[model samples]
Target: MRLSGERLVEYGEKGGCFVKKMTADDIKDIRELRELLEVGALKILFSKNNKQTIKELELICEDFTSMVEKGYYGGACEADVKFHEKIIEATGNERLLQIYHNSNIPLFHLKLGNALSHMDDYKQTDVEHRRIVDYLKNGKLKESIDTLLEHLDRGEKESIEF
Candidate 1:
């Protein structure tokens, strides 16, 4: 977990290791970094946007919806990660992709810490996901980015509350 950058363990000043409690500040920092990388890559994603790309995102959205309906919040979180990842990977920048994975943003959003994994309302998320894909499919970069920001902001708020 430490090697994965999940940082589940923290070393004490005296050299003993123990579980690290995740704080709101930690979640804020991770969310902000995620925003930076994801938002920065939007232009590249727009450039590479295509029907196939949109379809892939749509499929992820379908999976997310299905998971939410099944009451599998963990699977829904996984799908959420995949949706954002698909957008980033669409940029075709290997370094950016590697950095994104190394940053452990996906794990942060997953059930490991249970911070953002238990969002109270999944319907809003499903709608937001579809709206984003619709904006992308219609070549609305600004709208898509705005929706993405809103989506991320909602998750950050929920994570902080958790």
Candidate 2:
């Protein structure tokens, strides 16, 4: 049972994160919802909500930067995918998660070896991520969000200038 004031941090670590073993009580079914959302994102239907998408991405990058700054490589997956999962959550894209859960993960993990080699870039990434978070927390949501999306795009291309 979840006790009062149970923080997620207690379930994991201060800097490094882990996948907690789960039971049926912790699971929820969302196959259809995820399929629908994935299809929408893939088809670019969410293009209309571009601004919202950007802000969410910023939040993601901030988390990545934080973990890296703490001297941890982050999580079980590539930095980009792990970071994007955070973005997906902030977007409240329930359906999109399904797609991540079912497909994107494998594709991303396949390239994780290369991503691990880029761990040294964590320091720079951390600064960029922190800037994004400051923008969001300080009401510069639009600018921060745009920066976030651009950061992700750059990471995907492995040509991140910032």
Candidate 3:
């Protein structure tokens, strides 16, 4: 796991495995990597077909909003992952998608449960997700990426504090 760059786990030479504690720095590092991959994918997505992609993301945004409004944070997290994954998938680069999956970015929500515990943040997340989809539909790549970074940064802050 160490050789593969899995930060969540560590295997001791004494023949035991342990769950590695996540520090604030570790969360920050993961957030930075996520930003890089997601921003790069968004740039690539702009060069390709986005009509279908926009619709898919819009549907996800709706679901995410509904989940948040209903106070189902777990479901919201899943929808959040779907929304971001759709953006990455629209890039049409299999390797990029694979790297995103391997990075386990989706697990952050679970790992930092307190991050999404606030209703205010949930509402903000919904609004941000809708804005991202709208920006993409309007051919505003820069705005979409900017909103994405803002969204990720908010989560990172909450995670670190938690």
> Per-residue alpha-carbon lDDT of model 3 for 1-162, expressed as tens digits?
653376667788997877677789888988998899999998998878579888989899889888878888888878888888888889999999999878877676465643457888778888998998788889898998999999999989988776
What are the models' TM-scores?
0.86, 0.44, 0.87
Q: Which candidate leads the pack in lDDT?
A: 3
Candidate 1, residue 61: the lDDT equals 94
Candidate 3, superposed: residue stretches over 4 Å from native: 1-5, 11-18, 113-115
Which number leads on TM-score? 3
Best-to-worst ranking by lDDT: 3, 1, 2
In model 2, where do residues sit more than 4 Å from their true spots?
1-81, 105-110, 113-116, 159-162
Predicted candidate 2 versus true structure: per-residue lDDT over 1-162, tens digit per residue? 232132222344456544333232221122233334433442342334455555666656665666555655634234546544554554566766665666434343334323444665555555656665566555565565566555544444442221
lDDT of 3 at 16: 80
Against the reference, the lDDT scores of all candidates come to: 0.80, 0.47, 0.83
List of clashing residue pairs for candidate 2: none
- Candidate 1 residues lying further than 4 Å off, grouped into runs, are 1-6, 12-18, 112-119
Tens-place lDDT per residue, model 1, 64-159, is 989988888878878888888888888889999999988877766674324444445578888998998998889998998898889888777776
User: What are the root-mean-square deviations of the candidates from the true structure over C-alphas?
Assistant: 2.6, 12.5, 2.5
The per-residue C-alpha lDDT of model 2 at residue 153 equals 45
Ranking by TM-score: 3, 1, 2
